[model samples]
Target chain A: MRAVVTVMLKDGVLDPQGKAIGQALHGLGFPQVGEVRAGKVIELTLDERDPQAARVAAEQMAKKLLANSVIERFEVEIVA
Target chain B: MRAVVTVMLKDGVLDPQGKAIGQALHGLGFPQVGEVRAGKVIELTLDERDPQAARVAAEQMAKKLLANSVIERFEVEIVA
Candidate 1:
């Protein structure tokens, strides 16, 4: 199975990288862009057999490795 | 309107950051994880009045600012 995991800074968390990118975009002439928040995407292939099992494993991966629970939240989606 | 732009390193491009994250996941005992590619997701609010125009503007944003076309590709999706 293939899965996509997205990890993003929680609301109210400071995102310097995102801010820098937004500034760069503005400098590049995208003046209509109001606000920008940056996050991470992880695409992974897993060998888990069952859909439920894959979801469990993917969630575990998010909690244990993919996301920093202190300042981030993650979502996982399986792609067929 | 809101848009999500995903930018990822092209295949065959070296992704040290991705590799490091993969290694960290492995170290955390996710041995079943075969490969990992890290990418960026940018969420933005746009003021464009037309959807088609927003798409065009978003594409230009990807090319000129959000993505390094030399070794990356980007996809933008509008979410309301």
Candidate 2:
């Protein structure tokens, strides 16, 4: 099975890297762009066959190691 | 409007960072985990109101700056 974990900065958290990226994009001529926030996507190809099981496992991975639970939130999607 | 740009490494490209992350996860006792791939997700809050236009604009951003076209493939999703 395949599981995808999307991790993003939690609301109210400061994202300096994301701010820098937004400015970089603007300087690169994408003037129409506004605020740009960045995040991580972790794709896991797991041995688990059940989608529900894979999602649970992936969520655990996200909480334990893939993301900073205090400052980031993660969503898991089962793709296979 | 909001747009999401996901950038991922192309197949066959060496992913040393991802491999290291996987190893770190394994060492952390998450043995059930298998192959893991990492990517970037850029979330843009645009001035444009139309979803299609937001998507198109974000795609251009991905092609020109958000992603390294040579070794990465990007997918754009309009969330607003």
Q: What DockQ does each prediction reach against the true complex?
A: 0.82, 0.81
lDDT of 2 by residue, B1-80 (tens): 88989999998888887788788878877776788889999998998978888888888888888899999999988885
Tell me the spans in candidate 1 whose CA falls farther than 4 Å from its real position: none
User: Best DockQ goes to which candidate?
Assistant: 1
C-alpha lDDT values of all predictions: 0.87, 0.86
lDDT of 1 by residue, A1-77 (tens): 87789999999999998898888888988888887899999987777667777778889989988899999999999
Q: How well does candidate 1 score on lDDT at residue B78?
A: 88
Which pairs of residues clash in candidate 2, taking residues 3 or more apart in a chain or in different chains?
none
lDDT of 1 by residue, B20-40 (tens): 877887888887777778999
